[model samples]
Target: MKFQLDEQQGGNAISRHDGQCVWVNGQPHRASLLVPWRGEVQPWPLSRFEDLTEAHFEQILACKPELVVFGSGARIRFARPQLYRSLIQARIGVETMDLGAACRTYNVLASEGRAVLAALLIDPE
Candidate 1:
């Protein structure tokens, strides 16, 4: 479940070494136990929010991921205090890293059969 990404046809594509699944951006090629983009892929999960708003909290709760990796596109940022607390309450671990690092982390964790969710944003230009 090591995922290698490719820039194909002007969009991002994901390829996994173990052939478990493939995704373009966050959309899975087939229905998977892991749901990508359960919410809007941009501001909600990918970015560091000011607070754990109801919608954001609900989305993460629904995912029930053992770990949630936030790819802040190109930088690392701390989560809002409320958001951090909510995740802790849900017994989920959180990692905030740059997009590339987040991607790598997600692949490794997913390969280990951990329920992992990633929110990555791609620079359009």
Candidate 2:
């Protein structure tokens, strides 16, 4: 689906997304990636929800966002809390949803100037 956020001065926004890929700032990406509000976009190195691990969450922590909008491919899937205990203990919130929803919500939160990260996984298929 075509997704967009009001072009803010900084922060990455998803311009489009399909189950297999997402366009960040109009650049198409088939692999998982991390888009932090007002920061550089980086590869997340994940293809599916099952591939998630503590290391991935730690990577998100490195971005230092107040919240993470996790896009679990084309379906809504919740990661085990233990996978993100560090974020919880750090008081950073995580909201899990499908890629489409995450993209849309990320746009809204990001536009509001919230410190947010979009942890999106594109289906390997």
Q: Write down the lDDT of every candidate, Cα atoms only.
A: 0.52, 0.88
Which candidate wins on TM-score? 2
lDDT digits (tens) for residues 1-125 of candidate 1:
82443332332334431122335455653211222323233234322333335556556667677787765444565656575576788888878886667766766665555667775543321
Worst 10 residues of 2 by lDDT: 2-11
RMSD of 2: 2.7
What residue runs in model 2 are displaced by over 4 Å at the alpha carbon? 1-6
What is the overall TM-score of model 2 with all chains considered together?
0.92
Cα-based lDDT at residue 4, candidate 1: 42
* Residues 1-125 of candidate 2: C-alpha lDDT, one tens digit per residue: 73543576677788889888889888898899998988678999887678789999999998899999999888888999999999999999999999999998998899888999999988864
Cα RMSD (Å) between model 1 and the true structure? 8.7
Per-residue error for 43 in candidate 1, Å, reads 9.5
* Model 1 lDDT-worst window of ten: 30-39
